[model samples]
Structure formats: C-alpha cells, structure tokens
Target chain A: MTWVTFLGNATDPKIGGIAFFGIFLSLVVFLIGQWLFKISNGFFLFQPLFVGMVLGIFILWLLSKWFGVALPTFYTAAYKPGGDILFWFLNPATIAFAVPLYRRNDVFKKFWLEIILSLVVGMVISLFAIYYISKGLGLNNDVISSMLPQAATTAIAMPISGAIGGTPAVTAMACILNAVLIYALADILIKVFRLNSDPVGAGLGLGTAGHTVGSAKAVQLGSVQGAMASIAVVVISIVVDVVVPPFAHMMGLF
Target chain B: MASNATQAKNQAPEHEPAPILQQMAIFASVLFVSSLISPLFPKSFPVPTPVIGLVLMYLLLATHIIKLYQIEKMADFLISLIAFLFVPSGVQMAASLNVFTEHGPMDGVMMIVTIILATIILLVVIAYTTACFMWVSRKLFHKSTDVE
Candidate 1:
C-alpha cells in the first residue's frame, strides 16, 4: 500500500493506483505512528527497529494502494526508503535527546573508562568477528561489517562503515535488524544463561551489544537497566564515531 | 548556616528544586559542554555534544555529586525520543522502489548477506562476554567478602 492513500489507503488500500499521493499518505501514517508512540507506554523506545518495521508495513500497504504496485514481498529485499514526508516528521528528534545528556553529567564523566572500554570491545569483537568469520564462511567483507555497528547507533555506524569501505546501506539495514531481533531475544538469552539479571548487567549488554533495541529490552527488565542502556547507547555511538575509523585505518583493514 | 541548623528539626531537600527545572538545567549544561568539547575528539564521532557531555555526566553521577533520581524523568525523555529521530531514514529504506535497478543487486545482495551474518555472530559473542563479566564480578565479590 502506497502512503498516498493511508487513511487505510485513501479510504481503501485495496483500490491501488492513487498515482501521485504517495508522499501525502506517508505523512499521514508518520503522524499516526508518532501519536501512537506518545501514547503506547513508551514501548517504541525499546523496540525502535520493530516500530520502524511496523511503520514500514503500514506504509507499504498504503503505497501499494496509491501506486498500483504490489507491496514488496521479501522483507529484506523491500526498499522504498519510506517517503519525504516521513523524513520531515523525524527531523525534530534531535531536540528531544538533550534531557539525559544534561542530567547524567556525573555518570558520563566518572564512567568514561567503562563506557570507552565497552564500546571499543563491543565494536571490535562484533566487527572483526563478523568480518573474519564471514570471510571463512565465504561471505564478502561488507556483509560482515555491515553488522559490526548493528550493535552501535545508526548515525555513527553508517559513516564508520563507509570510511572503512564497508557498506553504509547494509550497516543501516543491519542496525535495524539487530534491534528488532535482540529486543525479541534478550530475555531468552538472559534466562537461558541464568544470568544475574541485574540492571547494570542488562543495561551494559543492551547498550554495548544490543544498542537501542537492547535498551528497549533493558527497560522491560527494569528502569535501572533502562538508564544504563540509554547512556550506553549514547556512549557507544560516540565511541564508534570517534574511534572506529582511525582504528580501522591503523589496522590497515580497509 | 541557618538553613543547615534548621534541617535537624525538619528535613529540607537541598538538591532538587522540582523535577522539571532540574531536568532543564541538566539538559542545558550537557548541550553547552558537548558543543564546547566535541572538537577534542576526532571527526568520526557520530554525535555532536552529548557524547563528550555524557563523559562528564558519568563522572559527576558516579561520585555522588549527582544523583540518578534527580534526572530520572529526563533520562526517560531522551530514550522516548530515539524512535522519532530515525523515522526518516527508516522510511527512506522502506520506500525506495528501484533500489535493485538503481544500486544493482550485486552490492545490495552482498550487503544484505553480510548484515545477517554479522548480527547473528554479534549476538552470540556479546551474550558470552557479558556472562563472563557477570561471573568474574560475582567471583570477585565473593572473594572480597571472604577476605573481609
């Protein structure tokens, strides 16, 4: 369904071929999704990747309605970049992040050692392990490292991949995929391992390894974990941005 | 001095004014510091201020100079906003129709394949490492208790 018709498809997504209303429809869906986010007990914070995907589905149905095209079938293969209207709605997001960065000043300064350590270790193990193992598996480098920062934030991960000659598109894609999968899998992993299930433990794992998606999982575990996870996301994204490229260059891996 | 003496009779909260104002102050401080110090890091860092500012926050919070409860709502607020920020990029990915014809299947194919493998392997390693740390910390905690 094309976005142009997303009042459940210009009053009916099945009626495809609304032609030029695609952007308009995406805007409507984005507004609805944003509202849903505000009202949904804050579930999207933990499951952003899934939230994005759910939005995508609605968008696909709407676009299909408007454009007379079948919705993209393969989940991984589908590609439309959503729409311009959606992008516009999201632009205000950077304004909202100032809260914690302000209050958590003490945590950020004192925990520098841990934050840096975790991000470096997390990115290194994740990136290289994927690279070498995938090479052993006969997959290309881009395929592996694209998932490297999957555990990291998108803004930093995308360009880091690009600088190191990895695939930015895939990096973006993998980050989303990991968030969804990890958010789903975190509990089982914790329970299966009989892990301590402490907030710090859950938070670090979520922030360092799980990224935003993991944080979502962390929140479900408890608020302390959520706090840790949130801080971790910011720290890891910063670390990945500042450290990965030069480190990648120094190692001559690119 | 007078307020300190009066505190024995009735406790007054010195640290927090109200949740909202404190949150605003915290936010303002971080943004200012991050913008000022962001340049100390290399060009590759993804975010502008909060990254550096976060380092500062961690230091203050851990030292008892700043308390977590003071900024709880503010922290939650940041987490809440994460979803909306990525909507544009997510939408772009969900909507781009001619990607195969435009970017070609070879690079895109290779890219998707790599991402899948990386994510699976990453999850395993992270889970393992976290368990290891938890084990180590527990063992160390026990050892310290025994010594005491």
Candidate 2:
C-alpha cells in the first residue's frame, strides 16, 4: 500500500489517518477561521476559535454523510487520538496564564478585596442561575453540570464538569458559547448598565462572565482593564474550583 | 515600580533572547512537575493540576526562582497559540451531534436560547454588581478616612 493510503484509510488501526489527519485538519480549519476573522475586521462574533470549531464540525459531518465515512469508526481511529494530544496541551497553556497574572501581581494586590467580593457574588449568581435555568428547561444532570462552569475558561471548566459528572464536550461547548455571547453583547450591557466609567469593574465582570474571550475584549478597552480581566479569569477559576463542587453537592446536583 | 519599569526598558536592548531550547526545557519541567503532582490528589478535589501548575509558576516568579525574562517569550508564544490547542477538542464536538439531533430541533433551539439568555444576564449582573460594590467600598473608605 502507498504512504497516502496508509495515512488516509480509517480501517487500518496502526498506520491510519487518525495520527496526522486531525492536526492537519485543525491547522486548515484554523487558517480558514483566521481568514474569516481578518475579513470581518476582528469582529468578536467572527472569532477564529469559534469559526474554526464550527467549520471543523461541519466538515466532519459532511465527510460522514456525503462521503459515507463511518463516524464512530473514524472517531475512534483518527479524531480521538489527534484531538487528545491537542487537548493535553491545554494544561500547559493554562499554566502559561500565570505569566500575565505574575506580571500584574500589583493590580491583584491593590484590588484584591474588591476582586474577591465581586467574583464570589458573581460566581454564586452564575451557579444558581445556570442551575435553575437548565433545570427549568428540563435538561438532565449531565447537561446542568456541563453548563454550571460555562463561565470559566475551558481548561478549568472541563475538569469541573468531569468532577461533577458532566461531559467535557458539553462543558466546552457551553464555555465557548458563554464567551461568544458575552463578547458579542458586552458593550451593550456596559452602556445599558452605565458600567463604562469603571474599567476595573467592567474588566472583572467581563472576565468573570466571559473568561479568556472577555479578557480579549477587555484588552481592547485598555491595559488596566485588560490586566484586571486577566486577573479575574484566574481568580474566578480558582474561586469556582474551590466552591462549585461543594455547592453542586449541597444542591444535590451530582 | 516606575524605576523597575524603566530599568526593564533600559535593559531591553542589552538583554539577549533566551535560547528556544532552554525556554522549552523550562516550560516542560514546570509542566512535568504539575502533571506529577496532579494525580496525587483524589478525583473529587476541585482544584485540578493545571491550576496547581499555574499557582506553582506564580510562586516561583514571586520568589525569584524563575525570572520573568527566562519564560516571558515562551509563555507568550504558548498563550497566543492557546486557541489553536483547543481547536481539536472543539472539533470533537462533532462527535456529539447525536445529542442535539436526539433531543429534536425544538429542544435544541430552546437550549441555545436558554444558554444565550443566561450568559447575557450573568454578564450584566456580574459587571453591575462589581461596579456597585466598588462604588460602595469607595464611599465607605472615603468617609472613614475623610479623603477624596
């Protein structure tokens, strides 16, 4: 068999397409997303990450449907391995977040009390809001758990979901959706609520509600706002990590 | 802080870039340590190891064990590419298409609407609440101290 066939064929477990295809496809999709974002003038809704995800999903769906590829077989053979490696990198990347936090340690100290109070209140409200809303919508526990940590970054949210018995994919989906929604609507919300004057407050809210994407928006606002947002991302993650599981347990969510 | 900032700026031209190999090694060592200690905790522990890794890095920096100059470039590069790392998992969402289809289109729409609404509410509430707290605190502190 030729080298191309060895890499493309789904049935061949050892030398199959799973090893390389996912990385290649991811890069291609990323480029497409970047192009879309560039042409769209860096519109938040046109974020390359979200674009790439949707495109990747659609392409996979098309492959499965039009080309008669067996999804289950392909998933186990190709997607899982490739995706797993990339997912593993999220850990180190998350660790890299410390660089920013370290850089802005003074800001953290200056507003530490305000940051803590805001995050605590925001997190409580977020948890309760997601709980009741998803429950009222008749969603199951897994879905509820997945959505609970939606306000956090994916690296933080995914494990929280696992600890709480939710699927990581659903949690990831919710987190991304949360970020996109906040990114798209943050300005309007700020204007409507008259939050334009308080950059630190705005940054904390953005980070607490929107995580990394929100921080990106905060960065656009100004350096102090960006720093505050970055700090919020870490603070909120740590707060939620320490508090959510117990809260979920008390609520009998698990 | 001003002096430190200026010093950093002045040192910029003289500072040589840390070799890529050394930077990678530092990153890998931190990651390795994080992974090593993460599994020691029970499954129910809320704080995951990556977070622990982050805290460790922060502590190292605070204590001057790891200088900012050593890892700044590598860390920035990794963070810039962070979204790229997440794409694979995002792609894996394709596998869960059955979840939406199985629940039917109406339910899916409801789910989407519910999530969007919740997110907006959360953002508004969090931002406003934080602003309010800051305002209140400033008032309280100012009144007690008799300062502007």
Model 2 chain A: worst 10 consecutive residues (lDDT sum): A2-11
Top candidate, metric lDDT? 2
lDDT of 2 by residue, A1-254 (tens): 64333334555666544466777778888898889889988776666777777887787766666545666545555566667767787776667767766666655656678778888887888788778888888887877777777766676778888888877876777776776566667777778887757777777877777776676667667656766777777788878778788888888878
TM of each candidate vs. truth: 0.62, 0.83
TM-score of chain B of each: 0.62, 0.78
Writing each residue's lDDT as its tens digit, candidate 2 over B24-113 gives: 788788878977887787655445667677778877866768777778788777767766776776677666656555667776766677
Interface RMSD of each: 7.1, 3.5
How badly does each model clash, as a count of residue pairs? 52, 1
| Candidate 1 docking class | incorrect
Candidate 2 recovers what fraction of true contacts?
Answer: 0.56
> Would candidate 2 be rated incorrect, acceptable, medium or high by CAPRI criteria?
medium
Give me the overall lDDT of model 1.
0.53
